[model samples]
Target: MCEWVNRIEYSLWTQHCDEGRRFGHMTKNISECMNSILKGVRNFPVCSLVKATYGRDNSEFTVAETTLTDSFSLGSYRVSLASQTCDCGYFQALHFPCPHALACCAYSWLTWEPYVHQLYRLNSVFSVYRMGFTPPISEGFWPPYDGPTVIPVPNKRRAREGRPTSTRIRTNMDEADPNRPKRCGLCRQPGHTRRSCPQLRGAEHTRGHD
Candidate 1:
């Protein structure tokens, strides 16, 4: 029986199953592929892992011309990969590649490292720490000050403190402009307010009888 089953083709075994093609099965699991990619990275420190991932040159570069559009605003920005500039000004101002420039780099299959400022690079950060700082001298060895000592005025000191009262002097500028005309709120006419308006008085008098 085993020898006869071995003689039959594998396709003959699955001929009765109608839904076999719809299963979308893969020969290799996705997690296994990811584990293979991150094989040695598991033991790496966070910073080293990030650096390794960023510096990895496994991706193949492709030649393609493409345009990037801002989805939210539906705006087109000109990005110059060679000059490391975008029309939005963020790339130049921040010394980092902006979204538009990053999109351009991705579309062109180019590396964005060249566009980034050296100040942000790991080498620059390492260089900063390479310099040895001079040890600070003891405070007792500091030079004495010859300048006059400042004394606080007793009158200026707060007498009572909850929230300190504002000491801002009221000036003419703080008041509303006198040249501007006041309007009557009830009639929408200049000179009198709604409280003293004749129309308001008439309305009150008419409503009193009803």
Candidate 2:
């Protein structure tokens, strides 16, 4: 299931999720995990993201039973043990084996560490950053300027030929931002949204009257 705010957010910050499961320990675990990750890598890239930022808590491996399956369910998790995925989306999203997957590993008597993506492993991350970066020399130390300058291109700067639709890409962060004064789609007026637009109401009113 999708959780809007974490348990720590509700219990420590605000009481939003009374019905939700309590994971008070995660506050410390998450903090320490992020701390270790930051200590490992400060930069981000598509390929290195999972490896530079993977750490499973000690809490995950403490599974109770010895049972393996293509599917496993307990509380919030709906894990597809075969595909190595969870309904929480953390597993596939990070390309690292999530807590749910690790739990399955424990039950199956399989080693938990191997289930995680190699990129997220400590040894892999440490190996890359171990090499020191060579310092770049100043422009004065550079070779003589020999290349021809190629720079006349106003035609190349023109916008692509297409009807430009006024739409912005929606991101997950947008959900947390405060609602803005929406513009009406019908009459193109500010202050009211498309749903509550007076122009739409007026049109409907006139149609009903007719």
Candidate 3:
């Protein structure tokens, strides 16, 4: 069953899916085979995992061409140089260029940097992470104060009761007699049995009525 699923995955990746993700130039299964590559790293330490992920992303940036995929930037883009419009609707929508526009510019030898917004550049990225995070100090290093420690009042505390009852408590459902009759057997009336029926004491009722 697992092998069948793997074959399906290999087919989808190599043959490409309908959602437009394809290896445009390549006609072979990826050399490393993603499942095999990732399986080994599944149990990597947290730091190693983060490092691996960051390194993987950076490696993707080195590859000039990329397949159009949902994870890339949302929608697939149509880049046309003549009209300078991208169907992704990002270039005109934000007027701040995107990867699709950059790809087009790069293809035409027309300097992609100008189209990319300055705030999205490497300098801006470097600026954001320039300051290292301040290290956390131990709790003991926190300032000491003379204020009374906030605690529950002695009277508010629950009585340290004796050992709890070992037996389970009975609920109404458990105590109810399932054998009890729905109607009185003696009177053929609702609500009680022959033993507890008021109709069974008809002579006494007659005397009271008299």
Best by TM-score: 1
* All candidates: TM-score: 0.35, 0.30, 0.27
lDDT string, candidate 3, 67-172, tens digits: 2221133246676543445787777667665678776555444665565557878898999888899999999999998999889997666667887444688788
Candidate 3 lDDT (Cα, whole model)? 0.62
Decide which is better by TM-score, 2 or 3.
2
Q: lDDT score, residue 56, model 3?
A: 68
What does candidate 2's lDDT look like per residue over 1-210, in tens digits? 336445334555443543433333344356675666566455767456566544333234334233334577757888876676899898888877787787776665678665577888888889998899999999999989889989969755645787655469878976754666656887788887888988788999999999
- Off-target runs (Cα >4 Å) in candidate 3 are 1-85, 92-108, 131-134, 141-182, 185-188, 191-210
lDDT of every predicted structure (CA atoms): 0.70, 0.66, 0.62
After superposition on all C-alphas, the RMSD of every candidate to the true structure, in Å, is 24.2, 34.0, 26.5
Quote the positional error of residue 207 for candidate 3 in Å.
31
What is the RMSD of candidate 1?
A: 24.2
Question: What digit string (tens of lDDT, one per residue) describes model 1 on residues 1-210?
Answer: 989987876544543442554233343466775556567896888887676655442231124223232221215777776666677999889999999877767666668888899999998899988999999999999999799998999878886759886789999888998798999877999988989999999999999999
